[model samples]
Target: MTIIRSLSEVSDNYRALFVDLWGCVHDGVRPIPGAVEALRAYRKTGGRVILVTNSPRPRAGVAKQIAGFGVTEDAYDDIATSGDSARVAMFRGAVGNKVWHLGPDHDAGFFEVPAILTDPAVIERVPLEQAEGIVCTGPFDPLADPSVMRPQFLAAKTRGLKLLCANPDIVVDRGETREWCAGALAQLYTEMGGESLYFGKPHPPIYDLARRRLGAIEDIGDSSILAIGDGPLTDAAGAMGEDLDLLFISGGLGAEETGTAIGGDPDPEKLDRYLAETGVVPTYTIGTLR
Candidate 1:
């Protein structure tokens, strides 16, 4: 219930941070103001910052993309992406051998097996009719509605194929534009009688991956860690479910609901109501990372 202006107010309370990338570090197109600096300052204080993102790209790919936004390596210690988490599941045959990819061509990296897995299943991307399961990295067109995949979802439902959702985010803000994500398609598929599996935020798989990534560097416990993000459902819910303290960013996706203008604090009453309605209680609140 406490609202603060910058991350520095509580960065000393935790040994590490599980930070969301899209709305927290960058607005998809570029890094948000003061975000990169806040992370750098945290690192300078010997606090590790892990970019735990719902991005449906491998960690390396995400690094390359973030570099374009000026989110340099000095800002954070490591990254745990939804794509890498879900890719491990795919290579382990969580879906099946012949799977249909319900996403754009840019997500072809999702099929690449990780080098760490000793023996991985042979996965092939085939037509929906010839598939045993489905893998959704994202929608073919993010700006379009999710209902457009009803026809394909119906066919997949008839065959009883399991859909592995890489990114469990419904939408993300790219500059001033909001775009749909893989979670939208997975939600539609489940609603239309198809089974869908999630590996991102609010789910245990990605969190496990994040812990493993953190363990590689230092032996930290959950009590000493904090989660920071902008999304109410994904970030807030995930942090709460993991029993970790969360620093909610009101100026990102929840800006309109919380009456938070850019680079400004949110209306207390509006922020409280939004959290109550969404059922997510964070340890702290901030306008932005700084």
Candidate 2:
């Protein structure tokens, strides 16, 4: 794959971009250096930017959160979130009317009814014993190991409760610390024979929503759009699945594996080996967004 220093080298080719949020634009706590400029510069060239994220928040919530990180409105056109996608399913009774929440209180927005569903099912958060299914936004404690939920998952499995996973990210590096996400819990539940439904990256529903959002702006085809992100499994897999070209940022989640140094490019040999091991071959590679 080609390794370049800035997104400008190839930004002219695509009419739009499907950009990942966490690792590509920011490190969770703050904005990454030059990421904002890169996005704004692309927008100046008339490229529509869709912040397609695996964040388990509605588009409005994501916008508010990113704005606090210095990502202004000028950087992108629209957003499509995994939370928005999964919420539609929830309102449609993908799990059931009564669901047991597995995440913390911050993610209670997952239970909100979407505006698109006029006749939405009335959802209620009940105890595990009274729950008809499960709505998992993330772990109750992200730092804790996912194995702690094995007993609960076994119980849910026994009762045949389906788990609707909002975020499919296994982990994200918040500044310098890594934290587990909902995907870990969903994976554990599935391993214990409990059905788990995913709505985030590497899944089709979020992409479908992203495309529809982009289509609302202009008629941009898959080949004319570039997908930029840091997740090898989620971003790369999602791009490959949709037959879209990818600009893989090795400095995010796979920084150590790809031997990418801070504010520098990845080690070519190590990046190659890592890509080969992961079985993800992107159209391009870069260390940082700019």
Candidate 3:
């Protein structure tokens, strides 16, 4: 694989790109430096770039949130979130089946299939045996205590209902706050002997969705399309599975321990150690695009 620096370094080969939203372009609150410029430049070159995110919100909802961060819809060709993919998957498989909504209310919009929002009061009376599957977006602030959530998973485990995780992200740092994602809940549920299906990134469905959305007008081959993000498990893994080039940003997912962008005294060594341990080698590793 080719290791490089700067977004400009990747200007030549790629004709299309699938950029991640949360970490690569923005941090859920604001846009990252050079991200907008890089995307604009890529578009200027007649390249197709699509923004894909694991946010547990529908495409329209996510578009509104992105607009809130000053990211206009014109920045990329299209946007696809895990929530949209999950709902599509759910609707494709079973229609009108009841689902146990297990995430934030904002994500509840994904499940239009007779979903029962996991309200605190309702949990007392409602049995997991009643639902067809559990649609999980992320941790519930009211039920994030684990003690309460575990019981729900336990109930689902006994019934053999699916736990479809809308967002497969394990954790995400919203500005200064780091919180768990649906993947974390799914991990716990899986440990409790429940089946979980991830909807975004690393999964083929979302990748195919992103590719279709990007348009790929230039007919770019595998090496000419890049997947850029900060997370190894999601972005890099997605690129690997899709046979696309990857640009892994270190500064977004984890805080800069060495106080550097790409690598410095401690950061470079730490990155090396992480790559060694995970065995997920990326085409490029940088601190930030700027």
TM per candidate? 0.99, 0.99, 0.87
**Residue range 1-290, candidate 2, lDDT tens digits:** 89999999999999999999999999999988889999999999999999999999999999999999999999999999999999999999999999999999998777778888899999999999999999999999999999999888888999999999999999999999999999989998888888999999999999999999999999999989999999988999999999999999999999999999887899999999999999888999999899
Candidate 2: Cα lDDT at 271: 96
Which lDDT tens digits does candidate 3 get at residues 1-290?
44455677776677877888887788779887777877887788887877889987877788889889978766787787887777776665531256677777666567553232332112211335678777787777722544558877887789888888888988787777777888888888899988888879788878877766665444556667888887778888888888887877777775454244533222677777666765667887777754
Clashing pairs in 3: 261-287
Ten-residue segment with the worst summed lDDT in candidate 1?
A: 107-116
Candidate 3, residue 252: how far the Cα is off, in Å: 1.4
> What residue runs in model 2 are displaced by over 4 Å at the alpha carbon?
none
**lDDT value for model 1:** 0.93
lDDT-best of 1 and 3: 1
Candidate achieving higher lDDT, 2 or 3 = 2
User: Against the unseen true structure, what C-alpha lDDT does each candidate score?
Assistant: 0.93, 0.94, 0.73
Instruction: Name model 1 segments beyond 4 Å from true.
Output: none
Pairs that collide in candidate 2 are: none
Error of 2 at 163 (Å): 0.4
TM-score of 3: 0.87
Clashing pairs in 1: 6-290
Please name the candidate that would achieve the greatest lDDT relative to the true structure.
2
